[model samples]
Target: MKRIAVLGMPNTGKSTFFNRFTGATASVGNWAGMTVDLMMATLKIGEVTADVIDLPGIYDLRGFSEDEMVVQRFLESTPLHLIIIILNTVQIDRQLSLALQIKRLQIPAILLLNMADEAPKFGVKVNAEKIAQHLEMPVISMSAKYGNQYGKGYDAAIDAIAQTLHQQEHPICVRNISDCAIDDRQLATELDAILQDAVHISTQHSNTLTTRLDRFLLHPILGLPLFFAAMYLMFQVVYTLGTPLQAFLSFGLDWIKVAALEPVFTPFPSFLKGFLIGGLYDGIGTVVAFIPVILLFFFCMAIVEDSGYLARSAFLMDAFMERLGLDGRSFVMSLMGFGCNVPAIMGTRVMRSPGLRMLSMLVIPFSLCSARLNVFIFMTTALFTPQVAPGVLFSLYLFSFAAALVTALLFKGQFPNHDPLVLELPPYRFPTIKQIFVRAWVEVKHFLRWSNQFIIAGVVIIWLLNHLPMDVPPASKQTLSGMIGQAVQPLLQPLGINSQLAIALIFGFVAKEVVLGGLAVIYGASNDAGLGGAIAHQIDWVQAYSFMLFTLLYIPCLSTIAVLKRESKSAKFATLAVVWSIALAWITSFLFYQGARLLGF
Candidate 1:
């Protein structure tokens, strides 16, 4: 197959462009380092089928960092013929330099001034024909993300690619080694001179829309607080809107259990009824009810991201997070973890250092992910007043970062990411309804795909443990989970954790969303009349908060652990992750409970 390599500097939408043509869902983010590996897919251009490879984004073709090395090695090993280099038209000042360097390679190239649609809004204009003449290559103005949803400018790009690939019969590189060894200083000066005539910008405008907004959004004092405020708002909205939807979902599930399911299972044996209807059905249904919260959280994030504010947040984050031995870009990974930790772990591939990538992988699990979000929603709403519920849930998010920062610092000496993180602030764009909904739909679909299987499997396992070895009345002391929780109760007593919560935690290890279902199964409460009230009566607010803290800090869900193992390529590191987190959860919960009691709470 003809090999076409998509190359560009970080955050130019290379992966986005690649996904458009290849129809592959390679992770695309608003920040840098999204494509850490060579993601290849089959592209059939008109009639010829070629192999499309999406290379890691880099500033210079010269190998500098781990990602750069990966790019260099792939270029050397793979016989590539066409290079599709994407450039952000608004930031041509920085991006054009990379294109100039690629020009030196004398490869068969097609340059895309992507996101050109946003250039006019930012008071910048690019003459693609002029630039093409200056660089002696094909330059096309287009937008990859816009193309991602609609065929606005996408069809033209595909035609250009197909025509270019068909015409370029020679190999990608034909120049001698000396071509890239030219004087760097003189080359940059010459390149700037060439681009001067090809691009136009208004210098009279000091306060563009982006700069005007950044005054507050990226202020030295307010940036961090605003970021937190944004986070708090996201959760507040999630809880506020999600709770009612959660109640609605619970109603549907209760109807199914009593009216739809119970009738069918009426003739079954006690063990089967208890295991399937009450245990499995009730357990899975409880977690499913919280899907609205998950959906809302992702929808809000999608809007924030599409508006280009998320990249600015990453730029702002680089300043404060540097103290933790991580750059602000790590903030993106941490937030992605809120959706799911597996992709976030894979996202560490964007960090340049092997050690730094590992540090990022470690920091992510501590982020309060959606799986744990369900458990928090249940505990906070069940335990606290409406006025206090958002506060409690929001505080847990704060603690998530608190724990993550401490974890990053403790591992600072062990894993240091020395290279400074470089991120370009993308021009702020007005988010369109279509873009927002598209993003929401994709996330909702992913949430269901990534979660449904895990949820069902975890719920079924909890059902078995509650019923097997004896036909114990569901959640009785003789159950297997009960015996195990009893054995561990003394260890957890310091944190005011009871036997039921202990068993729930054990099942939660499979997946945190299961904790609520585990509660319903163990407490013998129906979905509509389930453990929410029981938990409120069983434990005081102090213990409830303490229990929430313990849940927040305990080990990563099984899927995260498995990914950590795979990414770190060591069982020992994964084992360390499990041990460290559980230890922290225990100690943190213990101190909180004991101190709260002493303070007369």
Candidate 2:
């Protein structure tokens, strides 16, 4: 199969272009740093099956950012049949320099001017044929975002690929060092000539929508407060809409357990039946019930991200972030961490400096990931009134940021970053319903995949621990789980975490989503008394708050640790993350629990 690579500067709509053919919704955020790693998918161009690799966005071939290194390494190591370099039509004058650099490599290539529909509005005009003639390569002007569907651009792109493949020359096997070593000044002069011949921008045209929006959204005094209010409102919508659906799903799942599965297990022995129903059904079902909530949160986040406000938020936070020895890009990684920390850790590759990347790795794991969101939502609803539950959840999110800030402050001296922030603010666009749904479904599928990989196994293990020895009452002090939990209970006692909760925490090391499953198994939550009821009966609001705090501050899941080890390339650094998080969690929860107790809570 032929190999093609799609490359571009950030926010060029490259991922959306890739998705047009693959039918896979790889993250399509209207921001820089979204594509931190290479994404590969199969492409078919008229009976030709080729592998298409979407590379991380980079500004310059010689740039020192880890993402630039990624692109450099791929080109140096991997042979390629073609390179599809995309440039935003509005930014073509500046982006064409990257095209010139790639041209010097002597690789077979095509140039795609994405977002062509918005060019005229920005008072930009691109002469594709002129560019093609000047560069001796095919240049196509098309909107990747809108042209892929019901538009001629999609068909034109496919046909262009098919023809190019049929007429292709030898594949690129090695770097053309002499050609690539051309003087930068010469390349700049050539780039300017090409732009003068093929591109035009009217001085009268400006993106009024972006200008007006940024005036308010990026204001120094009001920007931060507005961002916070928007986030709080988003959380409110997710909870208010998702909670009822979650309850309905939970009820339906319980009905299945009692009405369907119970009859199937009736012929088995009592112990076997208990394992099937309580260990497997109840435990897994409890976690599954929250799928609606997860989907809602992802959906809301997708709209915010695709509408292009996420990048603005990063810019607004840059000043505060720089004071902590980081920058706006690191803040972007932290916000993305709210979805999942493993990818966020990998996303740190966007940092140009090693010190900044390490600092970001230390801070991102503290973001309140969706898994922890599941746990906090469950606890707050069970322990607090509806009127106060949103406040409790919001407070947890605040604590997540607080924890991240403190982590940065504590570790900044060891790892210092002097890299200045350079970020692009894309024009705001209303996200299409199709894009919103696709993005949300993609994330939901990810949650389900993680659940299958970790939560089921965690539930089974927790059940075995509680039911082993075949003599003691389930979850009793003599059982394996109880004994294990008791061993660590002493240390957790000050934080109001009991033996059962201790065991849950141990299981949660596998994945935070499994914490809910472990709790359901430990408590033997049934249709009559659901997990919420069991939890409410087991712990008061204070103990529940303490557990939530610990969960928020402790080491992230094992997958995250593995990514940290791989990305940081240091077992010692990964180990330090674990140790520091545990210490911080213990101390913070201890102080809160002690203070609350003293206040007569």
Backbone clash pairs for candidate 2 read none
> Could you tell me the TM-score of candidate 2?
0.95
Candidate 2 residue 536 Cα shift, in angstroms, is 0.2
How would you encode candidate 1's per-residue C-alpha lDDT over 1-601 as one tens digit per residue?
Answer: 6878899987787766776577654443322333233467776798767877787778777766656666766665555678889988778887887777777776778888888777777678788888889878888888887774543456777788889888877656433434465568976886778668878887764436778899989898988889889888887898899999999999998888888888899899877887787778877788788888888888888878767788887788787788888887788888888888877787776676777788888889998888888888988888888889998999998899899998988997888778778776776776666556656666777666666767676677776776666745555668787788789989998899998888888878887877887787776632235668877777899988888898988999898898899778889999989999999999899999999999999
lDDT of each: 0.78, 0.85
TM-score of each: 0.86, 0.95
Among all windows of 10 consecutive residues in model 1, the one with the lowest summed lDDT is 28-37
- Per-residue CA lDDT of model 2 for 36-91, tens digit only, reads 34667776778777878888888888757788877877787678888899889898
Runs off by more than 4 Å, candidate 1: 1-6, 15-56, 72-83, 100-109, 121-123, 133-137, 145-152, 165-190, 315-317, 353-355, 524-528, 565-572
lDDT of 1 at 566: 79
- Quality of model 2 by C-alpha lDDT: 0.85
Residue pairs with backbone atoms closer than 3 Å in model 1 (clashes): 317-328, 318-328
Q: Largest TM-score belongs to which candidate?
A: 2
Alpha-carbon runs more than 4 Å astray in model 2: 25-37, 148-151, 176-179, 525-528
